[model samples]
Target chain A: MRSVILSITAVLLALLIGAGILLLSGASPIAAYSALVHGAFGDAQAWQRTLEKSTPLVFSGLAVAFAFKAGLFNIGAQGQLLLGAIIAAAVGFGVEGLPAVVHAPLALLAGAAAGAVFAAIAGALKVYTGAHEVITTIMLNYIAINLTDYLANGPWKDTSPGNIVARTPRILDTAALPTWGPVPSGFVLSIVLAAIIYWLLWKTTFGFEIRTVGQNRHAARYAGIRVARTVILTMLISGLFAGLGGAVETQGVVGRYQPGFNVGLGFEGITIALLAKTHPFGVIPAALLVGAMKAGSSQMQFVADVPKEIIDVIQALILFFIAADFLLRRLLRLKAEAGEERLVLSTGWGSGE
Target chain B: MNPWRTLWHYNRGKVLAAAALVVFVVWAYTRDPQIVEAVLASSLRLSIPLILGALCGLIGERSGVINIGIEGQMLLAAFVAFLVNVYTGNLLLATLSGMLVGAVLGFFLAFMSVTLRIDQIIGGTVINMLAFGLTGYFYQVGLVTKGKFAPIPIPGLADIPILGAMFFRNPPLTYLTLLLIFVVQFWLFYTPWGLRTRAVGEHPRAADTVGIDVYKMRYLNVTLAGSLAGLAGAYLTLEAVGSFERAMTNGQGFVALAVMIFGRWNPILAWGAALLFGFATALQTQLQFMNAAQIPASLLWLKQIPHQFIGMLPYLLTIIVLAGVGGRTRPPAAVGQPYVKE
Candidate 1:
């Protein structure tokens, strides 16, 4: 409950800071903000776009949150997601003569599996060699970017007439994720997955092991848990979630794998995870909030003649406030509650030894 | 006792590096005699920012602060420096402005890690996001600079065969970075200040037990180190590219961290690592050029490789090097841990 309040305050404070930036830049804060709000929530179309944006964020947020539960920082979600999107596209377009039910599920599973395998590389490196995941994951992201770019432009280039862009061939109609009225099926899947993850974290024995390892690896080892196995499995599962996000994006919205279209979907997962305070269920609301901002940004730019990047600035400010909660607590005069569990994202480098 | 075997046993990294250099020289000479000088000169040119970024990381980590925000610092500094150059047409002022921005950012990181006790990684992420957003927000399309800094050839030295061309014929920042490599090497090992910084990083509690102020040492070192990263940023806009692009620092800052680990946090060794990585980058570009032209029969198959795969070479090499060396190197004992006075 207290965390909820803190998150709310952080958002408000971030908005205030954002307004100050607008004012200093000689723009009317009121006009810009009103346009932003109207653009995000004014119509059903706006809400639909928000939900579409939120779907990927939910998966990516869960990926980061799940890893955080194991005391690992999965900064390579971008890479994992890229591989997922491309593999899904490969299965979606290349494999012909399949029914809708079979093709869609196959593509999704293939993408998620690719993501899992990619993430496992870093996890195995951490366990066997004590190589820091933070560094390895970041390097993996660049590799994924280049590898995917090569696949799209070289082997899988859309060789159809007049297609010069670096992107894969469009998925078959049967493989595309369906939209029910105004709501996307992929968004529904994300919400259901979030619920399942919450249950898994709170109720399962494996989840107990993950939490224990996160809290103290030495204690977890003493208690007869295989800490190394838990770390690797956690990463694999985390990658699966992020990969699913990319799969959904390609099947639901993009209809194909394109480089620039999925640029920062994975990085935004970090912001959403932190904003949700690493809570599985909390990810939904946090993703929706960020999604709304993203949805409205273009309209805000059009209406107020302000740059769309202001949304990113506001989002960063919100993360800053949440990460440095003491500043917010001091301003609000809130007392620290006893036995509050602080978020521990990682131990320092070489701690794997 | 064989002298060569004894040297290998005592200094394995140096021996391996020398062997690699010998192989590279042989290969380049075989390809084309002039290729050696061209590749070496380009390698050194490409390594300027990387060497500076590694030095920045070296100083901060030696004082017990993990500066993952180096990328953000460089990006922001590059943007500010580019804007200054565009308006003032003075390269010196633009470079100083970039350094100032970096110093301020370093101070902010110090406050978060040392005073507020926020997680250092999270703090760095915040800085990165803020820099990316701010630069993108204010950047005007098609803003041009007057010109970039011209290379200054040292008269006598630049004319002295291939070796001189590799080292002497370079822009102002490249020369400064080369001199800084030796200066930092000496300062880190021979100065009393270096001793205190190491003490703070290794055993802050022990340093605190004596008269040394741990917080002060950290703040000073991190801020000063930030200026080096800022210098790297200035080099990007004012010296190297002569313009700013959003997130232009790319992953070089992170690569610097990998280089730092590969060098085992030593300044001189880090220079060697930066050069090796820089050589990989140079080779990739050269391979692309060869792919475009009519290549020799021996290397004809190289043309079949796609360009994107060539771009992946440096990043993949970083992962391989880190996996090989990460376990062997030890970081500062108290690095990444916020110090609290009892």
Candidate 2:
């Protein structure tokens, strides 16, 4: 309940600040926000776009949230997502003549596997070499971006006649994820995955072990847990989630892997995870909220002449309030919850007491 | 403990240099030797921004603050510097304003990391996000046009051989970066203030017990480091490219963090690491310009190497160095922890 309240307060504060900025910029805050709402939910098509946008965000949010359970910050979700996306696109287009049932799942699984392997590199580095995951993941992201761009532009360029853009050929119809009415099948799968992740984190023994390690690594070690194994496994699972996101984006929306088409989707996951307070179940609504913001931004720009970049500002402000939550706590006059576990993300430099 | 033995113990550099020289001689036999000079000059230009950025991390980490927002700070400063230059046309004012903006952001970082006691990484991420949004929005309004600094050659010095062309014939900020590396190294190791900063980062509790104002030291170091990062940002627009683009700092700020780790948090070592990274980066364009087809016809496979792979070299090398060498280097003992007086 406290988490819910805190989340609501942070969202409200962000909106208020955003409104103030809108007013300062000579736009009617109310009209702009109304246009944003209408753009996201005013019609069936709008709802479809919003849901479509939210699908990958949900997956990436779950990725970050799951890693937080094992005291890992998987900033490499972007890279992992990219790898998954390209692999999925490759499998989607390269192999031909398979039934939809077989081909789609195959592509998705290949993407997920690629992501898991990519993330496991960071996990292995952390355990064996003590290289910080944050730095390693960040480095991996740059490499991933360049790798995908190269493949698209060079060897993997669409070989179709008259094609000039750097992208893969379209996936076969059988490999595409189908939508049910206004709701995308990908969005439904995301929700189901969120439920499964919630159960895995809260109900399963493995989940308990991950949480234990996150709370206190020394204590978890004293309790005889294989701390290293848990950390690596957590990262693998996290990468799986992000990879699934990329795969879904390919199979469901994009239908082909293209540079710049999926630029900020993975980063949006960070904002969603933080807003959800890293709860697996909370990711669904958090991702939806952000998706709506993204979906509506263009319409807002078209209707009100407000720059679409305003969404970025709003997201940043929301993150600021969430990270610096003492201000929120003070504003709400909320007492500190007893026995609350403070965030413990990484062990700095050399190992010592 | 003998000096000669100690020098030999660090023989990795000697071996690597000799191997590189052999490769260079072989390559020069097939192509122009001047390509090597161009490579060195480009590496120096690339290393300036990176070295200054690493110094920012060096000071902040030395004072127990893990600043992951160097990228964001640089972005904001670049925008501000370009905006100031566009309006006033005064290069000095624009550069100073850029550093000032960086210092102000540093103050906020100190407030969040030190006073608010937020997780240092989270705080830094916030700064990055904020900078991204703020700069992207304002960059449009600033309406900056072409404003690059012309290269100023030092009289007589610029007339020398390869060394002069690489070092002396450059913009003022590039020279400042070269000097800053030494100045930062001297201040970090030789000065009393530097000792106190290091002490606080290593063990703030002990530092507090010794009557050091741990908070003050952290705040000062982080804020001052922001100015250095800001200077690096100013260099991006004023010295390097002479214009601003959204997210123009790119991942150089994060690469700077890796450089800091590669150098084991020492300014001099960090400068060396920055140059190595700079060399890797410069190699990318040079390889493209001096097309791989130029390689002896027998080495046909080299021609197949794609430009994208070449671009990936610096980032990939960063990961290798971090996993291999950086893992052994210890950061300041109390880094990423907020100090609390008991």
Candidate 3:
């Protein structure tokens, strides 16, 4: 209940800050916000766009949140997502004559596997060499960017005449994710995955080991929990979630793997996970809220002459308020609860031991 | 200890750097004699911002605060510096204003990490997102700088064949960065303030017990470090590129973090690491140029490799270096932990 209050308060404060920024920039806050709302929820198309945006966020959010359960910061979700996306595009286009069920699942699994392998590189580095994931994942993100760009432009380039852009061929229709009336099937799959993740984290024994390692590594080690294996497994699963998100984007929305199309989608997962307070199920509403903001940003720009980047600023402010909740607690005069488990993501650099 | 072993232990980084330089010089001589000078000069120019950013990171980390927001600091600083140059047309004022902005950001980070006790990583992420958004939101088309700082070659020193072109003949900021590197190295190792700062980072409780103010040291170190990052930003706009683009700092700020780790948080060694990365970047650029230009028959093999793969050299090298040496290099103890007075 307290968390719910905190989340709501943080959102309100962030929106207020966004309004102040808008006013400072010589725009009417009311007009801009109303336009944003109308664009996001004003009609069926807007709602569909919001759902599409939210689907990726759900996968990425679960990715980061799952890794958090094992005290890992999987900052390489961006890279893993890229790998997943490109591989999925390859499988989608390269494979032919299969039934829709077999082809679609095959492409998705291939993408997921690519992401899992990429994330495991960082995980293995952390477990074996004490190299921090924060730094390694960041480097991997840049490498992935360059690698994906190479594949799209060089080997996977669409050879059809009049196509000059860096992108792969469009996936076969059989590989496409279907949509219901006003709803993307990808969105439904995301919600189902979130529920499954919730169960995995709370109900499974491996999940117990992950949480135990997260809380106290030494204690978990003493309890014979195989801390190193757990850490690697957590990262693998985390990458799988991000990879699945990318696959869905390619198969459902983009229909082809294009350079620059997936930019910031993986990074936005960081914002969503934090706003949800790393809760698997809570990711749904958080993703929806952010998805709505993204969906309406262009409309806000047209209606109010405000830059769409304002949404990013507001999102950052929301994260700041949530991460530093004491500011909100002080403003609201909320009492501190005893024995609260503070969210400390990783034990600094070089604490792999 | 044996004298030779002791010398190797004390100057391992320098020895390795010297060895690498010998190999590079030999390789360049075999490829094209004139290419050596151009690549060396380009490498030094490329390394200026990276060196400054790494120093900024090392200082904050040495004082117990992990600053992952250096990229944001440099990006915002670059944007502000570019704007100041456009409006004021005073290069000095623009550069100083950039540093001032960086210091203010540093203070904000300290407040979040020290006073509020937020997760340091999350605080850094907030800074990054906020900077990206603010810069992108306000950025407009058609804004131009009046002028940029011209290279001021040092007398006699600039006359030297390769060394002069690499170091002496440079812009004002380049000279300043070179001087700052040694200044920082001396200060970090020799000064009383340095000892106190190190104490706070290693063991804040022990530091508090010994009359050192852990929180104050952190605030001071982190805020000062912000100016270094700011200088890096200013260098990007005023020294390297004459114009500002949205997100111009790119990933150099993060690369600076890698340099810091590869150097084990030492200012002097970090400079060497920065130069290595700079060389990688220069080589990549040179290869791309060569590919675009009419290449000699001897260099036909270089054209076979894609430009994107060449571009990946620095980032890939960073990962390899970290995986190889990251475990061996120890960070300051008590880092990323919020201290509370009992």
**Model 3 chain B: lowest-lDDT 10 consecutive positions:** B1-10
Predicted candidate 3 versus true structure: per-residue lDDT over B1-342, tens digit per residue: 343464467657667767988687877666776677788899999899989999999999999999989999999999999999999999999999989888889998999999999989888888988888889888888998889999999999997867888898899999999999999987887798988888898999999999998999999999999999999999999989988998888788888988888777888778888998998889767766764455668777876788888877877877777775533777898889889998
Give, for candidate 1 chain A, the lowest lDDT window spanning 10 residues. A344-353
**DockQ of candidate 3 relative to the true structure:** 0.71
Using DockQ, rank the candidates from best to worst.
Answer: 3, 1, 2
Off by over 4 Å in 3: A336-339, B1-14, B23-33, B291-300
Q: On a 0 to 1 TM-score scale, where does candidate 1 land against the true structure? A: 0.96
Residue-level lDDT of model 1, residues B1-342, one tens digit each, is 443354356558665766888687877667776767787888988888888888998898899888888888899999999999999999999999999998998988898889888888888788888888889999889999979999988999997666676888898888889999888877877788988888999999999998799999989989988888989999999998999998899888888888887777888778888998988888767766754464677776776777878778778877877786533667888888889999
- lDDT tens per residue, model 2, A44-140: 9999999999999999999988888787888899999999999999999999999999999999999999889999899888888777888788888
lDDT of 1 at A159: 90
**What proportion of the true contacts does each candidate reproduce?**
0.59, 0.59, 0.69
Q: Write the per-residue lDDT of candidate 2 for residues B4-33, one digit (tens) a residue.
A: 354346545744664696577457535664
Candidate 3: residue pairs that collide: none
Off by over 4 Å in 1: B1-10, B19-31, B291-297
**DockQ list for all candidates:** 0.64, 0.60, 0.71
Clashing pairs in 2: none
Runs in model 2 deviating more than 4 A are: A349-353, B1-33, B141-146, B291-303
